[model samples]
Target: MATVVPEESTASTEVKAHEVRPPRKPSASQIAAARSLPNNNEAVWPAFTTKLPSSLYIDEDRFDEEHRKLFMTLPLPLAPSALLAEPGSFVCRDGFGQSVILTRDKDGKVHALVNSCRHRGSRVTENDEPAKGRLMICPYHAWSYDLSGKLMAVPRREVFGELDKSELGMVKLPCVEKGGIIWVKMDHEANDDFSHVSDELVADFDALGVADMHMFALRKHEVEGNWKLILDTFLEGYHVIRLHVQTVGPLYEDTVVQVDRLGSHLRQTSARVGFTKDILAQNEESVDDLRRVVTYVYTLLPNVAFICSQDYCNMLVMQPKGVGKTIVHNFMLTNVNPQSEKLRQKWEKSLELTDGLAFPEDFSASAATYQGLTTGVVKELMIGGMEVAMEHYHEMIEEMVARA
Candidate 1:
């Protein structure tokens, strides 16, 4: 018989820093959640049902308000640092409804520029793919800017006599690189203070080794649903045993999740079928892989979802195209580059399991749910006990929207 430990017994014990920890170990919150894992016969559930208005998902006016208040004001994690691994590399992205260029200067500093030329207002580089170069020259008139967005050269410099180069630089957005992710605020006038990104969230990501990972694969999907709906699919495990039954269902325990709030953000940990308390009792210095026994999902509120698997991590960036449209960018990251053909094939297989099988199931469900909400018959969506994290998520969004 499996012995069930009381939640207090595990929750009260502090995990010391001096103890030898496992590689790519759990964050402090994750450690606590792991310690409180319920036995096979025991179950955990939310205490109340959260009522969310259908307008939150289908009303265009409400969507516009959210876009203005939350999306425009908050700092969003836009891209993986591995996307700009080499100095002088850059990628043009328009997922946020604005054409922006992310570049790493020769000195290895990252910058987010408006992507338009200072002179003619044309995009400096149109290529969406990652490329390496020192200067971004506008094809319109050959005006050029360096990787740092400094207007370096003008073909007809003599034509514009007394023009100040310093005042002609491209519009630069505030950017910060932390936890191997590039966070950018869309409002150029907003202060550079990123205090909204809490220390606990960064420490959790650092523990997951996101900074040193390799960008294995990236895929973008356009879904006919609100961006929040797409994000809701990742916040709970309630549907895994139902919606994903044919694919990833059997691997996860239904309604067996541990959720902790990291400020406004959330961290959800779930044990696999074979998980045992003994897994957590192993010597911290031992080479045991925690990912084998548990899975971690980090929701960096309002936009990103980071899911950790045994081998690779999936980082999903949900960009709202409209009230009922979204562009979901999925990035698969691994600890090491897949140099060998065999290794590349191995990761490819994992991608197919997610991007191919499991993800489509969630996307389809979100799209269908949005379609139903648009009919105006359903006034309120009930968030049940199994989806408590999602309830907290919506509450945070409501608070931010109201305050902003």
Candidate 2:
């Protein structure tokens, strides 16, 4: 492990960390909602029906608009903070066709920068080269930039008239580390705000100890489907029995879910089919009990999903690749292993089972839906009453796109 960097006077770090509050336990009502889902069988629904136009998924112009107006403008979720554990650690990603680099500086602050060079617009960091806190030198013209995005060297002085290096740094985006994940607004302008995301919801993520957990795997898979098609799997339980019958079918119920909306985000907790009769018989269950007892699927609308099970959490970032393609980046996190071999194998087997069985089912279904959409059978998508979260997701996308 690298030495922890000291906190500095950086604006990005100061603004995010100051207002965060300690996490509070979930209320009794939340516990009841999770536990009683199978009993009541009623999912929370929106005020009106949501009908999604088919062109939103198939048309190239709408897809491009979604990328520019929604993805670039919204605070999009990226990798876990664990990936940047060491100072100078960084990750490269693609945002709406722009190559982005998220790096943690020596002062323990994370920054998002456009990866192109300031002089010739060439990439600063090569895929094979190390891109730590050291200077990022452009391959095209040898222009170098420091970790704080300041130009350091231009090679050969007085080449093209008088030039100031201070104004020629990499393009900086507004990025903040919160809820154990890093979020960046790629097209952030002055006075940009992410206050639409509720503080209580962020605190809910904190209660899960997302930042403190160890990240075991980071996998990226390309789905041959519209981004919204991929989100349906994360937002609804209705497809589990049909699409995931062989993999995770035995573990979850269909059409029975507890839905909660936190601003643009939504949480769907379904009663596990495997919840034994023994656990429910206990007289009193604690506030933190439902998480371990039920299956939770949270969709941070626009482009992210976090699914939590008994032993592990899988969070995903869906980036639009084209009108009918999406790149899904997922991070799997779990508790650190115990000293004993038996306990170690328990977590190991669970993660292995999840990796082997669950994800393939999801990706295959996404591809199937993508191919099916090209058939032109359905002109619009009908969001049923049971799939309320999916309805909420579609509505939110329309609202944002309409305003944008």
TM-score of model 1 (CA atoms): 0.91
Q: Estimate each model's TM-score.
A: 0.91, 0.83
lDDT of 2 by residue, 1-404 (tens): 00001112223332233223233465444555565554424434334456777787788888888887887777877677776767876666764778887888888898888888878788877552224657777878888887778899988968767998878988898888888888778773624587756675676677666776667677678888888887777777666666666655654554366678777777776655445435644422432345555666778768888887644577878888898888888777754424445444555566555555676677778788778778899788777666777767777788888897
Residue 4 local lDDT, model 1: 9
> Which ten-residue region of model 1 has the weakest summed lDDT?
1-10
lDDT of 2: 0.68
Residue-wise lDDT of candidate 1 within 60-134, one digit each (tens)? 899889888887898888988988889999899886668889999998999999988988899888877789987
What total of clashing residue pairs does each candidate reach?
Answer: 0, 0
Candidate 1, pairs of clashing residues: none
Q: Which stretches in model 2 have alpha-carbon errors above 4 Å? A: 1-24, 27-51, 126-131, 158-161, 188-190, 274-288, 337-348
